[model samples]
Target: GWARLADDPKALARLPTVAPGATEELDLHLSLETRLAEATAGETLTHGDLYPFNVLLTPDRVVVVDWPHAWIGPAHADLVMLLSSVALSGIDPEPFAVRHPLLTGVEPEAVDVLISAQAGFLLAIACSVDSTADPRLVRMMTELGRSSLRWLSTRTRSSGRSKSKG
Candidate 1:
């Protein structure tokens, strides 16, 4: 589930080079911390980790595994992580979206926002895990962060432009 995110043209176009100690990581972490704190304060559900590897599929049903990263927060956060991981595996998220609409809720844009934030947090964590030794993880985190930043930047710019026009 790391292929599509790594291969997406738009995502790649916006990808930034791997630069440890950069401002982008700092901003991303700050934003994530804010969301995490808010989620912790309010009503929220946890997932630990919902990657494909942890999902056990049978002919009749599917079961999710793992329970380390689990935390109470907005359900959208978990959904975003699941969908993003699916997308990364070069799979179409639309099918999953259709099957489990409740997982994502009504706001598609919010899904994007959540995914961007999750990616940033994940990237930061990945960077801290021996980034110098694992070039692949380092690259993945760098790209993910860049993609998240680009998406956030676009959202901000669009919102600003709309406000100006109003």
Candidate 2:
């Protein structure tokens, strides 16, 4: 599980240098896990990893590969993962989000939560693995970790401001 990995000692130890103050925020990932669990109360079939290359589309039918991470969770979780994966390619996910069939009638707030959770998960993965010990791969993973940390930090600040104003 992503949450499990986030809490793993090995995972934390493997993380590259992150932005200032981010370490404190990341240390609270367990609280994020609790929030995710609460938002994901409704169980449904979900393909955990829906990255662009994982799907195959020919002239006929479309095939989805990689199912080892599939599980039962909120429907929006899959949409969140797919959109987040798309975002990794520098594409804006908002326009695509509204058009996706799976995102129909889904709560945006729930998707936000899932996205935040996914970012945290990615941070763990980026930290824990060396990716064949390639220098380029290590750089990419480190960059991803930094990006996720920035995103989480921004979201945390915005959420806190929103709550304080209400």
Report the error of model 2 at residue 21, Å: 7.1
Write down the RMSD of all candidates, one decimal each: 8.5, 4.4
Best by lDDT: 2
Model 2 has a clash total of 0
TM-score of candidate 2 relative to the true fold: 0.66
List the pairs of residues colliding in candidate 2.
Answer: none
Over 72-164, each residue of candidate 2 has an lDDT whose tens digit, in order, gives 887777766666655556665667777888778876555556665676666665666655766665555445445444444444465463322
Regions of model 2 farther than 4 Å from truth = 1-24, 27-30, 98-101, 104-107, 130-166
TM-score of 1: 0.54
Positional deviation of residue 46's Cα in model 2 after best superposition, in angstroms: 1.0
Looking at model 2, residue 45 earns an lDDT score of: 82
**Candidates' C-alpha lDDT:** 0.52, 0.60
For model 1, the superposed segments whose C-alpha errors exceed 4 Å read 1-16, 19-35, 39-44, 90-100, 103-113, 131-166
Q: Lowest summed-lDDT stretch of 10 residues in model 2?
A: 157-166
Q: For model 1, give the 10-residue run with minimal summed lDDT.
A: 157-166
